[model samples]
Target chain A: MTIHTKTLKQLSQGLQTGEYSSQELTQAYLNRIQQHSTLNSFITVTETQAIAAAKQADALLAAGNAPLLTGIPMAHKDIFCTQGIKTSCGSKMLDNFIAPYNATVVDKFNTAGMISLGKLNMDEFAMGSSNETSFYGSALNPWADSTVPGGSSGGSAAAVAARLIPAATGTDTGGSIRQPAAFCGITGLKPTYGRVSRYGMIAYASSLDQGGPMAQTAEDAALMLQAMAGFDAKDSTSAQQDVPDYSANLNDSLKGLKIGLPKEFFDEGLNSEMATTIETAINEYKKMGAEIVEVSMPHLKLAIPAYYVIAPAECSANLQRMDGVRFGHRCTDPEDLNDLYIRSRGEGFGTEVKRRILVGTYALSAGYYDAYYIKAQKIRRLISEDFAKALETVDVIMGPVTPTPAFGIGEKTADPIEMYLADIYTIAINLAGLPAMSVPAGFIDNKPVGLQIIGNYFAEAKLLNVAHQYQQVTNWHQQTPKGFE
Target chain B: MSLTTDDVNKIAYLARLGINTEDTESYTADLSNMLNLVAQMSSVDTDNVAPMAHPLDTIQRLRPDQVTESNQRDNFQAIAPQVEEGLYLVPKVLD
Candidate 1:
């Protein structure tokens, strides 16, 4: 049996039943990664490390003491710092940077006995919506070579969608995980802001950044998230709440489940074809005993503006540590301190990253601080309130993950505004610090569309239950790319 | 609503990012487009709404001051471009 085709749950059972040794399974996935190198999904493949870890897992299985995730070869978004691995946040600035420590999320996964195949590619500093901004070249969508795999977490989504790996870790500062998952037609979750520890997961926007699981199935996502979530002392913003077993409620029935369809989500900017696809998926939910209600979030339109400001402002501050003196790329010849700083950052960062840093600096500058930064903060409050008020009336919010399915790679790159608009539907949930996910709904023009599920703060399990229940009735999540299959 | 070339240069200088002279025109235009997008925030009336700094609206959790980390200066500085005596070397700040 091909190990790549098995879901995380099925793989766990297979390991437990001696169907395949973890070493063989790990080798199978490594071989597939070699076979699909043209996808550009992986930036660094840890072949030696993965094989050694797989051997350890095989020994554990021989002792009948294997963890659920033992020997499961997976890829991590390059944003997560892996000890002794090159952790390029898809920017030339970090192309030479080797992380000295593992991100807390990486530590958690490693502790659970999951073997990492390597680091996946992403948008530079998790700044862009399309994978095109990656310094390592765009991660091509497995479905269509010309189209983009939605980014910041684009590589993670693409790898999972193409069945290169069963699951991968992704961070969502603003719809990075969910949007890419939508574009790739996979299951991706963005947990409540503090649900997952952000320590060593290189900060894009400290307040908005969150790490979650990207997998082919919601049930697989549930298993992966169970290991990734929880508080850590390393991350000061980490919540003090207990993480619920995400898989516990996966089989829960959707009977009497209340799903809110945000009228704003279906309004202008949503593609007509995507709307029809989302509606069809909602009807399936309706058939599964879910009640759909219309909810209004008037300030939702302002989310993009507020996010563009606040996220960059935080990013400008967070990325300041990358000065030429410390670990990261540095200019070869610098006339002075300012020249070193300027040239290093200029050469290291990509166009999108520099654009953001410039905008962020301008917003937080002496003259524009109140007019831009403070004003945007207030808009953020209004946006969060819109979500809070809506959640009070509904159990969860449902919407289209993107205006359209994965567009051609170079289509939106020329217009930054148009590119930013691609995340319009997914950004508000980030501003509100709510849990949300993208699950495969249906295909439009042979390109997959995702149904976005937005849940209240810490409502991750509920969102997974909704997606898992839906996945049971539909085969959308199982449709792999033509060539990859 | 739009940033002039001078404004773009000043922002880049403050951000410590050097832009090729030829790219300045595009940067000026792109930054202006982003600013125009952010200009949407000004139209909303946020009179009573307080500026939110954090999502949870919680105070910073204070921990007792103590040394919690072991010395990894050598390991940490191993990746630095230039390090001497455990100190990162940058162009001199003071003449």
Candidate 2:
């Protein structure tokens, strides 16, 4: 098998057995990344740093006490701050901003002896559903050249799907990771809020943003999460709860697992073919002794409207720090401080980002605060309650990740609302702050579909176990795109 | 409710974002469409529901008033768009 096609586990074993040196592995990935540069999956390629780190990892391996991820190649979403690297988050505002310190997640990965290839591309400030909002340009779906790979984790998903890198980190706010992972035909987990530290991940919406792993399989995702999931004193909102070993239950039997099917998820907006694809995947679970339960989450419909308000409102507050004076972009010949703030931000951000910021400003402004922001928060509570009530009756929830397969590049760009609707099936989980994953289920019109499996708070292990079992029964997750294979 | 160009301009001002005159019309339409989407929230009555600020609704953990991080002013200011002599330089506020 080609080195690029090897799963994280197989690569770890290869390293242990001296089948291939870390330097050789890192070089292979770097070569693939350069060869597939048309995918636009990376913003920065740290050839020197990756090789240097791999050499260090080789020394550790020779000493005989390295972690499973040691010497294994991976990339981080540009959203995470990597000290001395340009952590742009796919925005012109930070195009010149090199991080002064590592984000907690980056520090953790480095500590695990993982060699980072470089920074992956993402939507500007993690705003758009399609990665077209990225200042670095859109990352093409490896499945098809004309379609989007999904965003703000678009680069991360595309890179992993193309096997340019084994895995990459992605942050989700309103289904960024899972949606992109679905579109790209990979396994991605968005852990329950606070499960991963967000100290150095560029803040989009502080309350909703979460960092997680995107890989080719549930087992690989579990391995990445094992290194990523932990509490950090730096992120105040990070959960103090101990993280369970995600790999412990990967092979666990799915017998008697109760999977909830939310009635709202199969509404008229759902693509009929996509529905059939998800049904087939669920049928496979049923054959494995899992039971399907029909549940109602009426409030699921409000997730997008509520998310649009809360996420933007939090983002407006979080992003206020990007003014010209201290860091990020600055306008030349500014007349005054206000001019610097206005013109700098105007020159820095993209259209979608500006739209969200304006919407947030309006929602929080006088007279509209109660009418918009507060109302959305209250609806958020209802959405969370819906999940809480449903989880009481089922071990996990299953549904289609996106309404349809990957849309063409410019398909939904003109209509922001249409793009927002793409995330309808997945946003409720973030509102409820629950752990969820997207596992490749089947294909439609030559593109892939994902079966979203959502679990209660801090149930990442259970989600991984369920997904891993499904992967074992089927080869959907193992299928590579046409040219990539 | 739909936002007018006037409303969009006001919002852009409040956000400290300079919206070009040419883009204001589009921004108005887009922001209005988004607000219309957000208008759906009014259909649900959350009269007794408490606002959820955090997903888990957990209170923030307060750390003791101790300096955990050493000063890295130089390291941080190195990326500043305009900085000199350990101070971030901006237009004079009191001239």
Candidate 3:
């Protein structure tokens, strides 16, 4: 197979053995990205910058002092600021905004000499579940042209799944990374909230936003997460805990692993076929000497209502920086200061963004604060408590990543509530600040189903261990989309 | 829980986002739908539960009162839409 089809680890090995130079590998992926332009996976293609970075990697490799990611080419979701690159966060508001500095994640990857292809597209400010909310056109699922690659990390999922790049960086707030990873038949990890720094990653919901890895396999994700996970002094919320070597425990046996299946995740709204696919994957775990326990997260149904209130409220606060001022889009010839602020924001933000800001503003408004904002926060506590209780008895929780496989583009746009329900299975994990992953399980009507594996806080190594073991026995993750190959 | 157009108008004004006259109806409908969806929170009793402002509930880490960054006003102001003499230009706030 060509270099573009190789796993990230395989590419690293290839570079080490002199099979291809970093420049050659970078060129190969850039060519594939050009070939698959119709997928709209990238918001910016840094060909000139990528070539220079790859040359630098080649120099390090020549000296036999290259780091693990020395020559690997990857894409970052548009949310992470790359110094001097347009970090739009998939919104028109920052369309002209060239990042003045690098996000902590970008700095880490650059320090390891990783070559970035460019910024990948995403939901506007990472708000939508379906990427349909992106100001840049929605990224298409490589599995089916008409279907959406899930968002707010849609482009990251699409590019990685289509093999335009071996892997990409993605941020998950409410199932953005995992859902798209499921729809696109790839592996995605949403690390525990504070595990990754949020310094220059454009904020969506401050408490829920987290950056992680999306790749073709659990091993690749583990490798990427190794570099991405660490505390930065710049991010006030960064955890002070020591970073663990994610790849160190990937080969651990799954025998005696206690997996919890939340009843609410498999209840009424789940598609029957999708549930069956998840069941088969669970049975595979059972055959591997793992024990499955049924657990109840009774307040999981409250997650959506709570998340809708809390996320928007935080989003409204977080996105207030985009008003026409020092930076970002400015409306033409404003009559006054108020006119400038209102018109610039109104014109800059998309429909879903506006709707969210409005909802958030209303929720946090004086008279409604106790009724809506505080109530949602109380419900958030209950949801987190439920996960905390369930996780005490089981090593990990297993569920469907999304309620169904990929839905067609434009299907749920008119009804925002229907679209919000797509994230039902995944949102509670975010609310609880737990680490979770989505791995390819099987297919439904030719679309891939994702088996979501959620672990307790700081349990990324265990999650990767479980997923790596499952991937060793099943070929689901290795399956590539037809035309993309 | 249904929000009227007037309510939406007030909310938009509070948010400082201008809604075009033509799009007001749709914006009102969309905002109302979202509010209705979130209205379920009020039905659940949360009398004694403490409001969670953050996930980990970690307090902000305070650093020593020392300067960590050097002045880069020129570099920072370079990206501003309108700037003059290292100062960001904005609409007149007072006479």
Assess each prediction's global lDDT (C-alpha) against the native: 0.91, 0.94, 0.92
Q: Give the per-residue lDDT of model 2 (tens digit) for A39-101.
A: 999999999999999999999998899988999999999999999999998999999999999
TM per model? 0.99, 0.99, 0.99
The candidate 1 chain A region of ten consecutive residues with least summed lDDT is A1-10
Per-residue alpha-carbon lDDT of candidate 1 for residues B10-87, written as tens digits (9 for 90 to 100): 889999988999999999999899888888887889989898878888777888999999999999999999999989
Clashes of each: 0, 0, 0
- Candidate 1: RMSD over Cα atoms? 0.9
DockQ of 1: 0.86
Tell me, by DockQ, which candidate is best.
2
Q: Pairing residues by index, what is the TM-score of model 2?
A: 0.99
Docking class of 1: high
TM-score, prediction 3: 0.99
lDDT ranking, high to low: 2, 3, 1
Once superposed on the true structure, which residue ranges of model 3 sit more than 4 Å away at CA?
none
Report residue A402 deviation for candidate 3 (angstroms): 0.8
Number of the candidate with higher DockQ, 1 or 3: 1
In order of DockQ, best first, we have 2, 1, 3
